[model samples]
Target: MDPAIEAIRTFNRFFTRHVGAIDARFLDTEANLPEARLLFEIARQEPVQANLLQAALGLDRGYLSRMIARFEDRGWIMRDRFEADARTRPIRMTEAGREAFDKIDQRQRAAVAHDLNRLDAVAQDDLVQALTKARLLLDPDAPAEFIIRSARIGEVSQVAARQSILYAASHGWGRELETLEAETTAAFLRRFKPGREECWVADLSGTMAGAVFLTDEGDSLARLRLLHVEPFARRRGIGGALVDECVRFARDRQYDRIILWTHTVLDAARRIYAHHGFECIATEVHHEFGEPVQGETWQLRLTA
Candidate 1:
């Protein structure tokens, strides 16, 4: 009767019916999971660093090397040393690989759509709504495989600088810089409960591309704070993963709510928060750095 076991069974059933067919038709024909994953990564047309892929997929170095080798042999992807750094190698899909991946993607989408179409319009909407809510609710209490490890203390300053610059530039914080006291910023971090606060730096290969933080505000509330992804890490789902970790941590701790702060200028962070069912509950114009700025508060309720 355990919920975890029940969820596992539910997923196993779903995967058995949906995943088996897709895997057999697409992945089985081309290669194993690793190869197919690499193919998809290359097909994205982004110069993916090998170490990034390794961390994202959580594969052993030897296994990833073997997977890349197979793709190289098949000419599905081309590996090139990073232009800025010869030591780092990034990969991209070849023209032929793109064409192949398109077919595979189309087939998978169609296969998934076919089943969804079986549900009536209202039922489909209901299903989607239910799933979205379930995900947020389940996420807060989920066990985390990744731990909040250490980060360079300097990165905190770097992240804050980038965030403030970007925030000010986009949001017209002309004099706001004067209001943002370094002491206040330091205090915010300093307030974190030592035993409960956690920070994780996501190292994409050798690059520290993103960071996330979780802070316990009270017994029933936790604040997911200071999630930042470098410009280079944008669109890679790094931000989403970081937020998800915070949500999971809160859930595991039985927190009733998870809260975060942002200004209107941070659209990407707002979107991620919205996607995870966080809603803006309060807004105010505050003076910061000698400039007036609008700040927003958002909260995701973990309990119904």
Candidate 2:
């Protein structure tokens, strides 16, 4: 077997045992791991559909039906039909279910805290960050809320350097990308317009997850520049939100159109722009980033 596979299996085995994931009664609760997990899923997102729950957990329909029956019998959850669609029944946690979930949640928290308390503060922080990164790596849409806000002068100015470093590790890009980003951002700062131009940053837990800038082009045209999301922050709609925000700002400012220049390598960003009604107007071979590549020009007509 490959060494990497063996190492991953070894870590999985150790972590599963450490977390008591295979325990017959997880965390000393009456519910087994599966039952406890189902309860947690329901508690976090109550009024969830049964089909969604089954698909989310990859449980068989029969098994999920039985589980729902068990929950209903225990008065933990109640199933009710939709007003507009009697064929659809939504599952909601009852008062008893809330109590049960709270117990399990509290117990799990205490157990984890006990283990974390053994480590020093730095070690604990490192472990937490590692776990967060692992989850993001495994599931890009892991439901992280990045706070989107107007970029302050200091924060907006730093995006060029931050973006340069952020993409360098993944794309193996060099000073060329940095220089391009610096020039555009520098120009944006120099030609600042109070309400006509703006930059927004998507902040995740005090870190800049992504950023985009809107700049006036003197012809009733607003151009989106420096649109990027960190790799760890992708698949969470951050890029799409940034684009939507920019387009909305352009429409509000009465711009005739919003245009952006992006590379063909950026499939995700292109999809986002297209989704927001940006039509590809042009493409050309360019060495802007020190590499011969197809660059794209996408524009959205705001009059519509």
Best by lDDT: 2
Worst 10 residues of 1 by lDDT: 140-149
Query: Where does candidate 1 stray beyond 4 Å?
Result: 1-150, 172-181, 188-191
TM-score for each prediction?
A: 0.46, 0.57
Query: Residue 75: error of model 2 in Å?
Result: 24
How high is the lDDT of residue 276 in model 1? 93
By TM-score, the best candidate is 2
Tens-place lDDT per residue, model 1, 36-84, is: 6667766664688878877777889888888778777887778685376
lDDT of 2 by residue, 1-304 (tens): 6998898899999999998999987988767778888999998777888888888899998888887888888899987854565225788899998988899999999999999989997688668757766677687776776778999657676789878887677666778989988888888888899899999998765556789999999889999998888778877788988888898899899999988898788788788888999999999998766767798999999896
